[model samples]
Target: MYNSIKEIVTAANETGKTIAELTIEQECQLSGKSRDEIWQRMTVNLQTMQAAVQRGESGRGVFSQTHLTGGEAVKIKNYRASHHPLSGDVMMAAVQGAIATNEVNAAMGVVCATPTAGSSGTLPGILFMLKERLSLTKKQMIDFLFTAGGVGLVIANHAGIAGATGGCQAEVGSASAMGAAAAVEAANGTPEQSAQAMSIAISNLLGLVCDPIAGLVEIPCVKRNAIGAGNALIAADMALAGCTSKIPTDECIMAMDKVGRGLPASLRETGIGGLAGTPTGQAIKARIFGNEV
Candidate 1:
């Protein structure tokens, strides 16, 4: 039911329903559960996301033996508290949230796998930031999750949302797209604008590789989530300003699939390529794993 962006938007437009409403209706029909049940389930996910964000913000990111990435989020947080961050409050907040969530994941903390664990940081990062900035209620935040879920459903159905299957373009890219759509909806944008935001997000990060150093979801992964959050915010802003993507959302997803298929095996979640293959990356891996790379 409504696996394509076009279908989702059309249904939303025709029924005078938001994307979240359409998605909730679909979930109820498919699971034979009441709307309340679905809402309760998503609330659990929202709480989990919130907890991870809290842990991350408190600087609990260093979980690996190497201790490479845990303190960056905390550093950013500290810097923001004292200095005027060049990116402003909302962006700084998004960056901290994204880093904190990914830090939690890297440190083996609990996190909601929005589409997947590797890309979990984007949605919550943007949502929590916007929640405070826009004075959004808990119900409005849940609606944001549902709107994001709807975008992710279409992407997963059409292309794929895993790094091994479709590279980081699928992971962070899809998550950014989901975050963008959700941001638009949370700001009272039309479903069509949400679709446009999703497209802009996907297009912005196309062809990104999943080359985590040592095959660990640290290193560039956490920072990439930060960038993904930024992309989502800017894309949402663009959509709200009436900017439209030239390629349609569904077609953009198709292109993502084609690019994913064409990516070299070494680039697709294999630590043997990209950043993981660099001299510094290999040196870090050797240091961490005690292996001669």
Candidate 2:
């Protein structure tokens, strides 16, 4: 039997675990300890990446950016000036780096089928960025993660997480929903508000598709994460303010599933439609594949 979004969130609260951790625990219970073991390995991988970043050893691939803080106007100017040439703020940069460069650092084990490697940066990135801003303790961070996990598990059970299977709703949509729920929890929103945030996220990203270029997760994938993160913030705020969507979270997830199912194969992760069909995408493919297709 499929678990509803509310049910999942309730379970998460009861277990005192994040959605990701709960997912691992459930996997372990059903499939042995393999998933849990893999999660531990991924944790080590993330630590190594963070260390490399601290050492300035890893080159910023697609969207690398210099860190900045302070005066709003100055920060705005800096953001605009450094926006070009890509920066670390872009979700695509991280995702592309993860997939094309095999430089994953962990968030939800997107390298596996459940999450795409390219879209893997959003959840972890948002959480890390929040932690940096709030100076949250490790325990707090874990708690936030557990809250987010409950929302994610609901989406997985009600909708999906595979772009190939559910288009961008599964990829960016799910990520945004997870981020929104996480943000709400981090902000101390009630469980009901967290679920509302997820609903808002799904409603906003209803028909998004998976259209990577040259079969690569770059292009729209990375930029989409930044947008998704922003959306998550918006949704969380709205939910926290006591705004409720006409459609419930579970209904929204179901709608997303229906929309994804209706998408043509070309728009589905086959890299045959949307931005993937653009001239730039074709040229990149030519350069990379040498007309092999």
Candidate 3:
């Protein structure tokens, strides 16, 4: 519904409405759904996210058929439980939570793609981790999803959120930005701060390529969501602390489009460059698909 970050932020400030409210209202107008209907839909999304996270951080964890990604989320949880993590509870919980969602996705389990299935872990991973710490109610968490949706809409309009189109910078990178903006509103930060957070988060992962080993989402894709979650949390805290991005959000979005367009096809989810080109990567692909390599 919003064309640019500038337009969304300025309007939110002037109208004295939260980004969540603005986005929900717009969705109502666009979809002809009542406010309650829209709210209910987002509630279902949040619930689905919760279910995936719960499954991931719990016993054994769901493993992918490829046998590449499984139980890593529980391992992280157990590690945090037994030892004092250098990253602390919030950060490690986010890491575990993010890996859980992607692990489930890789296993062909259900997951609500925040923007894309490959990048589903970032938002819920960060959101649920912060929920208890922030004492956010169910409604507030739902509002956070709406805020994330609003931020994502802006980025999607100006650029792309698909790895095939814009690489991981557009997928995980945009998801990180969306999480940062939504986290800002959840923490009671301003629209300007949300813009700053969004910019900071996206720029952190700028030029990140999609280089899945074995052409599967099991390798770096799952762990990348962990990184995205951390980036979003840091960006949100920085914005709340009055930190600013040297680049504006709208300009950053445009630059992302340009950078993604300039990247070679080998780096754009083709799995023929970066890590995928390594001997080990090739061997794994060969093992999976036969001696095609």
Q: Mind giving the per-residue lDDT tens digits that candidate 1 earns over 1-293?
A: 88799999999999999999989998999999999999999999999999988888773445545577786777888888899888897899998898889988988889999878998898888999999899999999999999999879889988999898899999999999999999999999999999999999999999999898988999788889988899999999999999999999999999999999999988999887899999999998888887964
- Give per-model CA RMSD: 1.3, 6.9, 0.9
Q: Rank the candidates by lDDT, best first.
A: 3, 1, 2
Model 2 ranges with Cα > 4 A deviation:
9-114
**Model 3 weakest 10-residue run by lDDT:** 284-293
- lDDT value, residue 190 of candidate 1: 95
Q: What is the Cα-based lDDT of residue 82 in candidate 1?
A: 94
Candidate 3: list runs displaced more than 4 Å: none
lDDT of each: 0.90, 0.63, 0.92
* Candidate 2 pairs with clashing backbones: 18-146, 19-149, 19-150, 63-87, 63-88, 64-87, 64-88, 65-88, 91-222, 92-222
Best by TM-score: 3
Candidate closer to the true structure by TM-score (higher is better), 1 or 2: 1
Candidate 2 local lDDT, 220-257, one digit each (tens): 67557656666777788899999998887888988988
Q: Residue 267 of model 2: what lDDT?
A: 88
Q: Roughly what TM-score does model 3 have, to 2 decimal places?
A: 0.98
lDDT of 3: 0.92
Per-residue lDDT, model 2, residue 286, is 75
User: Residue 98's C-alpha lDDT in candidate 1?
Assistant: 89
